[model samples]
Target: MKKYLVQFKPFLIFIGTFFATYILLTLIYKSYLNHFESDDVDEITRIVGYNVDLLLHAFNSDVFIQKSVSNPWLEVWYNNDYVIRIVEGCNAVSVIILFISFVIAFSRKFKTTFLFILSGTLFIYILNIVRIALLAILLFRYPEKVHLFHGVLFPLMIYGVVFALWVFWVNKFSKYAK
Candidate 1:
């Protein structure tokens, strides 16, 4: 048992750090929500949703978008029609948490890891907002392909970016890479 434990120490450490970071972050986010009266989307999520609405409107001025962030829910209006409501799940916070965890697990130098995590998080955040905006547009334009676009393609796009980042880290930046 001791010998096997020694052999798998690095793997164990990675698993432990990943879970700890993910769980701790989740708890803190939840705790932050406790301060709010309404059970709407958290502040960060609201900002993301708002950004999505703005971006969509910018691309298509005729879309006539409005954000109704009454509580935690953010409803995007398309020409007075409530086209989409962004919930917590759409924020991509969970995805960022998972990305951070994996990067930390295979961390390199402190500065390198910190910068990578920061930049990667930002990239993911921007990509997610864009994803939401594009999704709204695509859904509006092609209501028939909701399942293909939202259920399949969008998820693959996000996950694909994360996977590529992981591969880059493992090959270029991670300690194991050297």
Candidate 2:
């Protein structure tokens, strides 16, 4: 028993830490998401995007305007200046995942582990951005599908990326491997 425990101690520590960090991140992420649901963060992102667009249009004279909708994410507009967009989505969670994955991958001391993790994180972030953009567009394009898009397909896609990344680490760089 003692011999087996010693053999697997490092793996156990790594898994324990990863799980703990994941849970803590999930909690913190939920809190941040909840805050945005309140309208403050949502409005701020929209206004910032709009203001930037306005400034761009001031010089270009191709400005546009936009407003928020029932979707509490962003308000975008485009015109002479440019286009302003408010983007909010797994932003906090994505940040949390990126940092966590980087740390864990670096811990493994593999030459390409961090790079793989970085690639995975970037992929997830891009996917998330597209997810939000698509959701907003879908809301405009097919109002009836909003429920299916937001409640089902959206989560399915993002979590699918996450799960893929998980498998990547386990199969390619797991500490448990002999």
TM-score of each: 0.90, 0.57
Candidate 2 error regions (>4 Å): 1-11, 23-73, 76-89, 92-107
Instruction: Indicate the TM-score of model 1.
Output: 0.90
Query: After superposition, which runs of candidate 1 have C-alpha atoms over 4 Å from their true positions?
Result: 63-71
Please provide the root mean square deviation of candidate 2 (C-alpha atoms, Å): 6.8
Choose the strongest candidate by TM-score. 1
Judge candidate 2 at residue 143 and give its lDDT: 67
Q: lDDT of each prediction vs. the true structure?
A: 0.82, 0.58
**Per-residue alpha-carbon lDDT of model 1 for 24-87, expressed as tens digits?**
9888877887776665456777788668867876777445433354655777665565666677
Candidate 2 lDDT score at position 9:
83
How high is the lDDT of residue 130 in model 2?
62
Per-residue lDDT tens digits for candidate 2, residues 61-97, read 3434454555444454333222224555435345546
Each prediction's RMSD over C-alphas, in Å, is 2.0, 6.8
